[model samples]
Target: MLARDESDLKRTPLHALHLARGGKMVPFAGYEMPVQYPAGVLKEHLHTRSHAGLFDVSHMGQIALRPKSGKVSDAALALERLVPQDILGVAPGRQRYAQFTNADGGILDDLMVANFGDHLFLVVNAACKAEDEAHLRKHLSDACDIDSLADRALIALQGPKAESALAKICADAPSMKFMDAGPRRVAGFDCFVSRSGYTGEDGFEISVPAEHAEALVTQLLDNPDVLPIGLGARDSLRLEAGLCLYGHDIDTTTTPVEAALEWSVQKSRRKGGARTGGFPGAEKILDQFERGAPRRRVGLKAQGRAPVREGAALFADADTGEAIGKVTSGGFGPSLNAPVAMGYLPTALSGIGTTVFAEVRGQRLPLAVAATPFVPNTYKR
Candidate 1:
């Protein structure tokens, strides 16, 4: 999500609740969102890692695509034209991570696609929603019914205890596993609950009606294990999980391969697979798959306590070093109690344990290319 002017910012259905909880509101994705609550970012980050954290992600965009032929596979096939994922293979009540790529092989936006038997549901970034909707309509309208779910609000219940907390209010929560998604009555409200989240933990992302968003969130928070988390903690959590933030770690400038997201592009979409080279930039992406991208995204661990922030230039040496790349996302990993970051580095220098330099505050600080999930992922399979 992109930041906007405060005066022009919008509010989510739970805006009043945020303010009531002493949230520190800031402009984000054209919305006045809470960056941190009274408990603060550090506590929120650690709280989420240990227990459950509820996030008000209502600013995101929810869209539905129903096939004109009344077959879900038809819609999936249509969607494959826009992304390089094997959407047709996604089973009912299952979800997959995908990206909308431009004609030049750059990532336009990363999104979640859930198969709902009859229709497909999509959750896209708030800042790119309008353009994403337009892109979908322009390409798939002839084969599917494109509907923007403007009345829905999104919330993510993530962490180690998320399932237990949610199961109390939604009995079906226990039956769902990772990547399982479908319509479920949550907190007695009709909603779509996906057993998936950005945080690398057992969690759920629920899509509730705008009118009942506050009630649902309030009910979840009533559980002592669940705390309200803001954007600050959310970023730190995803960063530690080795996940990408749309505009920061990925954007129109980076392809899935360059971003180290090649795992998301299934073999079915690659060369010699059942469906090969139909999506945009297939030539470039597939070629990268066959060979490799020049530069690759890698995890960076700072040698000291100071956090390395985004946009910090990377150097090949500590002194008189040539600029090799730049840090895309960097921050302190509360779980690891150390600074962690991610950036692009030439493939030759992207190996784990490779030492690099990050120019920060007129100093070239040494950083090691470490294995990701700066902390181990607790995702329940």
Candidate 2:
């Protein structure tokens, strides 16, 4: 693939801050983003595991769904038409993870939906934001007001000490629990704060106005415990946390069940539930929930010191014969001090501790089917 021109890439609200802090900018999701800072990926990854790490995720898409009927339930029900998740069950001040599945049960995109009383807030992947917005407008424009938040900037403060660092500026930060979300004055900026993050850690995702985003992030970074983190650390953190990266661990070709994301689908959307089988690909997805997907996503732990990377073919035996599966995401888990990978495997061979061989370089490396969140999550539930 040809590299995107840096001049043509979009810049986040904190682009200047990243440059000032010696961040190595790279093209990602049509945006000029910082992949790492002067601290380096390893240190950044470890720091986030131990202390608080601030991330500028402004390139992500923020959207609002306001019900024309003035009832949030109406908007939720409208959204349920697109996602298989029980959006109506997400109470006000709370959020839930969901996916936009296609007619063939493939995931269009995975997103976060938060109920904020009168309206619903959505955060979609940066790369798929345009398509996601178009989808919402095509299907839900009649029931709700689809507004794309183009002037907002999103940032994440994540880790064990994230709450303490955020609490210094936003007093209500300490009161919020996991998945709790609402509007708050964060460092004198009118921002939306959610106690949820991609990293399996206790953290907050804050959305502020574009103009004030830099100032707010600067304030948060001023805290002694908070450090500016980049995409390199963010990827490792989420991978170790067993969280899926939209285009990598999952994509339009992968379904929720096949990706090991059945938990995100509430019972209300399943067969025999109150409201069932109305979303796209309901038949195929629901069927998978009842029976099982042909293949399942599982954690892979490399037996040797060398790291197993993505696109590596997996085989049942050491001698590569027919490739049964492929690694979707893989790399060194700095927190684990070892190599961790995730991939798909046939249902019969996806059991925990089942051995599989990943073809890396010219040699086949032995890998074990391991339970995920290789590192335990620290969400303050």
Candidate 3:
């Protein structure tokens, strides 16, 4: 979600492999990453939509929180103190999306929390890794032991055929449903595979030792259905999927309620539940839940050829306009062959059929508030 200079960026284990494939590299989240390959973002995006696409997402932070007493509920309870989610309800081998919130109900970072039976597994934004780890250590030290898996590299295989391609190399991959994750051996290499990905498509994210990352990816690439995808396509894919990128869509200044992620906060943690209001910012969040957020993040489908970029202000019309909100992320949906964007709007203007306008190049483009996942999710559930 962040771009930077390439001079001193950290490299993932598969960075050289990306270079070999003619990747156009750039700096992102403190790492030297491939923004696109020779196939280009458009083709790469379309290819992933058709076949299988492999991506190196090792820049994400992977950590395991183990309780000293080996109590899963203790770790879940400890986690509950920091965020408003039903962590204690996580079943073994299942994962849920969670956001670390602040005292004022602002989001610190959104993450995936997996219940691994004996411990809790977390994957957070790479740019916020150090701070996230520190937050974990500072708060959960008495309840759990947090260990950052710095030696591991994460990669994802996504698309309609991702499962079949993965099954060719790993027997267990085909059996996973959405949100299922556990340790597995693929082509004799030890790894933890999850039936989840950032793309709207059904896929898997594999975490393996840094030393074995290349070998695993190499074998997967050898499959006829799999092609290497880059960050550019990855971003567009998630945007089309209606998934929120940490820094761009949801940030420390935004709360879950304002972000329209109430579905993520389980009902057990909401008001009237037996164990409610224990987490940070619970009062503010629950209050917002009842009274409704002042603003909401809504999907906009621009009805023309021009693509709207992020940060563009929204207006009622070209003349005598009032600033309503700003786009957080926008781009041409390769699959839809049209411009799509997401932004905040007042509650009164957030209905799916509502009409709005985005200011682009001194012109006003009409946009309709369509239901998101601009592309439907093909998740295997």
Candidate 4:
């Protein structure tokens, strides 16, 4: 269900509404999503930077896990055994960022895990949800029940003005803080709202029943600051925020250590030696922690206007042309107003001021390994 030949793309619950709003529909992760609305990608990007923008992320997978004994703590512990993140510490109405790993220590997918009252709520990548569910079912005990929220729709309202705009729609909005989750009525529909987002901004992700999604989105859009955004802008925004995409930036080939995501590995998971080593490739991951990884992901800034897309060859030295790594993601950053990218390179060549070359259109362009988040993120703490 990847974005390949799009002869048959899956439509989301708001597909018709997107078309009505003049969204340029495109195939992404098997879903026919709007890449931009009538406002255009650039406008939508800037608007989201300064105002609130509504995004239809229903294509993402939403799932719930419950303990058969009605003990939520036990369910979280069972999940902690699978992933490196400290799920057991997640408070009710709070969310934690986590990843699913393979036996080789490679990341299968990075996801959000929320303690939604008596049940655990998860929002996983649409492309990897099926595999994630299978893994959870295989690893979890029989007392845990896994349920997919396929009939649910998810939307993100992000940017500086997101809170103020969304507050007008839900009376209980102000009480929620970063990474918090709570149930509330949105547009007359019972919904789960989370104060976390991928765009590196203060935002909320609202999950509602599929049948009531369109109306909920329409009601939010009624506010002047809330505009409909699409996948194109979302990609640029996340990249600018120094976030990684699932298959490209982090994948089965790259471990969390090499991906520069050691922060996501909780401190408790790193303690007790082998006790925290049950996950995939635990030995290798532990070794990398003791000694740094060989290659590491870093941010790249090209010197020219020509943006180097993914797959651009990265070199160890400018004239050597010897491949050190490859660009995982690259594009024009609307916020930074320049070409920005992220990729991996040998540890020696990954320093902040290290110079490299990116092969773009048969010519090597000057590139420097620079600090990420080309633009500062305005996340609410």
Provide the TM-score for each candidate, comma-separated.
0.98, 0.99, 0.98, 0.96
* Lowest lDDT 10-residue stretch of candidate 1: 1-10
Query: What tens digits encode model 3's per-residue C-alpha lDDT throughout 318-348?
Result: 5666889989999999999998999999988
- In candidate 1, which residue ranges exceed 4 Å CA deviation? 1-4
Whole-model lDDT per candidate: 0.94, 0.94, 0.92, 0.88
Ranking by TM-score: 2, 1, 3, 4
lDDT of 2 by residue, 209-268 (tens): 999998998888888899999999999999999899988889888889999999999999
Report the C-alpha displacement of residue 23, candidate 4, in angstroms.
0.7
Give the Å error, residue 267, model 1: 0.9
Per-residue error (Å), model 2, residue 246: 1.1
- The global Cα lDDT (0 to 1) of model 2 is 0.94
Error of 4 at 349 (Å): 1.4
Compared to the true structure, candidate 4 yields what TM-score? 0.96
